[model samples]
Target: MTPHSSAPDLIPGDLPSRWNASTPTADDVPDLHALRSRHEVAAKGRASAGPEDTRSEVAGDGAAARTHVVVRDADGTARGWATAQDRAAGRVLVAVVVDPDLDDDTGDALAGALFAWAERAGVAQAQARGLAATQLDSGAFEPDARQQRRLEAAGYAHVRTWWQMRRPVTADDEAERPTGPGVRIRAVRRESGGMPDAADLVAVHDVLEQAFADHFNHHEETFDEFLARLRADPGHRWDHWWLAELVDDGAAEPVGALVASASLDDDGRTVGSYVDYLGVLRTARGRGVARSLLDAVLTDAAARGRSGVALEVDADSPTGAASLYRSIGFETSYVTQSWHRDVVVG
Candidate 1:
């Protein structure tokens, strides 16, 4: 058996003290739930799940790629947790959530242990498979002072900043869908569990791949990875997907498509519209395809009674997508940072 397989399975009986560091079981549910609840309250409800849910969601039976670790005090009280997911382009995204009351040293020790585990398992897998370097991203909604210090001291450097902005939906702000010459927007219609239309999917992927190709730290993600990752979300909705089609003189097939969806909070309120992916083929750029897609999304949000739209963009993006968002009434709400470190593979 591999080292990972040999890792101990963490369960409830073994809990209330030290975690097994290997397998995560159902008994860890309540503790994990509490951790998530605390983290969300501390983060002003920005984050939902605690360590247990995170582990189950990412490393559980349906997980595509995951690395997880738990932190505990001497008496076995869970103190902190960390996890990372493997995404397209062979990149691993890391997150560290700790109890605010813990001392800097304790937090650091927990985060450090998690990172070290990731380096050994997640990072090692990526390198051996010829994947790109790993990336660590951390977000803080409270006094992130200690969290930030821990990351920096652990050799993570700040790379990007983002805003978690939101706006209230109102009938007055609502407007009819925007359309320009040769541009049309419509909702995605999937017949069954089969994949979305092949041509449409390809166009959507092409548009996003090309549109963000020049942006900061841009990397290519496989089509399968993109589809699998989004579908894995418990909140994913088929009707929530949309596409922007650009026609030639209103006669030819669509040359571009955009995919977007709405995400609800635990209360089931239509909190916001999440742009899962947006794209416009090179042949369709500069013709308002993107603006048309945004209009459709906005219209949908307003109809659904959503409060606002939320998405992330690279702060140093070269293509100036941020400028477009600003023009559309999106603004910065919070900032998140990215850190990178080189990896040596065998």
Candidate 2:
């Protein structure tokens, strides 16, 4: 959810002649999607990424803050892909994947070379912003030992694990959702220009910024940065934003916010809604603000006949969020681990 930085795409060194690497192109999307999808299916028993997702990652305006490389073998067969997205001022999201069928030695070399290129790309972004160091963050499915080995070999440490959870939605969700007196959720107001009301947008940003402050890996992202990044996503929909407020004594105080995106398959069908961020203020705890915001998302998804709502949650959520999600029917579909490596800009 960030714009492409001024960082130039950096290439890996010492790659064998059999593997050709270059910045990805529109024509390269299908091959890249196939490669990653195969890896995803093998790792998670199903694919979570779509071809559009790969297109955005490698090409298009979505690559504005991203630097990516797609590798083709001697016969011009796509075999690997790597990307480093400038997620924030000093944070880069990195991905390095190879064809699941590659020989052990070939996969190791390819992953290493791609990861090295990503670090260079991250360093380039950091250097452009005049930062000393930037974090290279990436993830792998919990069952993907090969990926874990590559990450550890590339100097990344497994820092955290997350639960990718999803819950089916139906007509009954809206009617059966819980309620809290004096607390209600509403859509972000839009102006005539079709843009969200500035005040409402700021309120949503402020509420989320404050709500996640005490949470793990909380980063201080500016409002402008937040909007630009979210709007850059291909799945972003302005109408999917909402805020929960406590209307007391004729005043509505924002207490929670939820930001979701449309989840699409390779064929571009909206299969579900993915909750990108949902947070409730500390003062609003135990008042069901979090649940209410989720209910809003579920209702929206159900109205459109979306199959389900999916979200990623911290395995050890401090607020007992996991249990609440479980009570709402969310089941862990897969597990992913966050691996991180810090790079110093040259």
Candidate 3:
């Protein structure tokens, strides 16, 4: 890790100067929060995360590492910020926010400094493990043409497209309840303290792994990583989880599982339910497991007064999952583009 003072300091007049990039400390929280707020406001109410998410990203589990950079004006007011996380596959995930009004040069310089930090961090980790590869993953909102161009100019190649879809819940929409033989959908059981049991956690992980095995960019996350990552989200709720079991007298374990979480808007109403993961094992596929699990979630969302359910799907998924979501009444609201750069070791 770089020493706090070793990073370059920037001033307002130095519009294109290098900015200090390092791990976020307690003192940097306020500036990071302010930077996030600026970008969120500029995004016109489309941003999904806030300060809490930033805090959690910095405090990641030991397996992963995070770095946050802040650019400040001469008077010490924050002007830009960036965050990058190192995941298991040697890929560095980056999200950056700069003053939208800044000159193009300033924006480019800020982005350059952040990527430099990521490169250094990746190299350091590889050297420690005697490995030779590091990569980067980034996403740009499709509506932001300027950012999209900037990313491409910086040598990132678009690799995948993600669609954000939503469906509004209605009494009529719930009329077509799912019913099939030997299939049962139930709410995830919660303990007295409101925490889910170990079995529930395992089931959800199994379902997600099996469900996404054939999907685009599908990679198996270790059980520990899955639990840590899910629990890290502030929006995670115990009651919002669900499971699907196949009533097979001969089977020793449940056949399928689905995990859904609800997120509320500022008004405290359950505005949407996000299907975090839904899957059925290979042996259980085509037996109505997926539809039944989805119906269970939809029923719960309608009963809770939620306006709709939302999820992201791979635009090029081989399993035709997008069509399934479309069948369930989800409509494409927006698209996000994923850019990937191969890791180069010096």
Off by over 4 Å in 2: 1-11, 176-178
Quote model 3's TM-score.
0.84
**RMSD of every prediction:** 5.0, 4.0, 4.2
Query: How many angstroms is residue 173 displaced in model 2 relative to the true structure, after the best TM-score fit?
Result: 1.2
lDDT: the better of candidates 1 and 2: 2
Worst 10 residues of 3 by lDDT: 10-19
What does the lDDT read for residue 193 in candidate 1? 75
Give stretches of model 3 more than 4 Å off.
Answer: 1-6, 9-23, 26-31, 40-45, 59-65, 125-131, 173-176, 191-194, 250-253, 266-270
Candidate with top TM-score is 2
Task: Give the per-residue lDDT of model 2 (tens digit) for 1-346.
Answer: 1122221234455665645677777877888889988898878888878888878877765878888787777677778888888887778899988888889898898898889888988888889889999998999999999999999999999999999999999778756465577788999999999988999999999999999999877767899889987887778999999999999888999999999999997689889999999989999999989888898999999888899999999997898999999998999998999999988877
Query: Model 2 reaches what TM-score against the true structure?
Result: 0.94
lDDT of 1 by residue, 249-278 (tens): 666455556565556664555467777666
TM-score of each: 0.81, 0.94, 0.84
Clashing pairs in 2: 1-229, 3-65, 4-64, 4-65, 5-65
> How does model 3 fare in lDDT?
0.69
